[model samples]
Target: MAKETLLTYLDEQIEKKLADFDVAIDWDTRNHTIEVIVRLYAENTNHMAIDDREGVRSEEEIIEFEDAILLYDDQKAVFDEDDYLAVIPFAGKKGMQQKVIDALIMYLPEILVKGQDDLLDFLVSDEESIFELHFSPDYFQALQADMTTAKQERFLPYPSY
Candidate 1:
């Protein structure tokens, strides 16, 4: 199957699975990856309708949690830190599309509700799984912010200055 075909299938499946949420899927040709962005609005309120000074004033706010799922061909020639997670090995393989779809259906909802850390833990524990997980700089920042402890330790060691 062609890459475009795979992308279309993924889009359709993701849309169906996450019908309640706002979803956006993009195929990154340069990186050979599909980026899925899911957004869930927790709160949406419009407190005010009109005001004299502000013309059309309104206290409208939406609290949304936007998460991403990066799916890339694991059998790529070159590898990078940013390109690890949700491995879709379509290289000389059949029935890989269904496997990918199954993985997405199982994990996407958890990622939406429990956040990225849950997936990180799962990928770390399941070494035999096709999916690979690596922490990015943004992930570390989010992890640190989510931590409740007073002391925050660095996930990766840094050199002394």
Candidate 2:
């Protein structure tokens, strides 16, 4: 199926680009989106008091911190012609895959850094959605602002209406 192929390709790409993180992809039927869950292996240091009579102890625990990125292909929703966020042209399977790759390359670093938080709060924060990809607008804007002319041309030269 197309979904399986996309998931497999995404997994392979993630492994190549982000070997330190573990990724799992699944279809969210209710939301009509593919949820890619990424987990980072990290150490958690905790200081705990046992009891009034007992002494305190410091414990180091290894944990996998998880966050999810959602991708949706909503062919039905209409987009304005000049919308800069409308970069992904879901014309066909191959096109979709390439666009997703571009997005992943652009955003994954920030996502990984955000995931380093203990509560994994970044996933729950409100973010802008383009082609159903949820991302922080401020972060995206900063990325755009920081890009060189060549990098901008390379990254933003997607098919436009």
Best by lDDT: 1
lDDT of 1 by residue, 96-137 (tens): 344444456545565565544443333335343322223244
Worst window of 10 by summed lDDT in candidate 2: 47-56
Model 2 over residues 11-123: C-alpha lDDT tens digits?
A: 66777777765666665444334556766654444422112112333233554444565555455324343322223333223324344454565677656665465333322
TM-score of 2: 0.46
Model 1: per-residue Cα lDDT at residue 160: 17
Query: How much is the lDDT of residue 150 in candidate 1?
Result: 26
lDDT of candidates 1 onward, in order: 0.47, 0.46
* Candidate 2 off by > 4 Å: 1-5, 28-32, 47-60, 75-97, 117-135, 141-161
RMSD of each: 17.2, 11.8
lDDT minimum window of 10 residues, candidate 1: 152-161
**How much lDDT does candidate 2 score?**
0.46
lDDT of 1 at 152: 22
Per-residue lDDT of 157 in model 2: 19
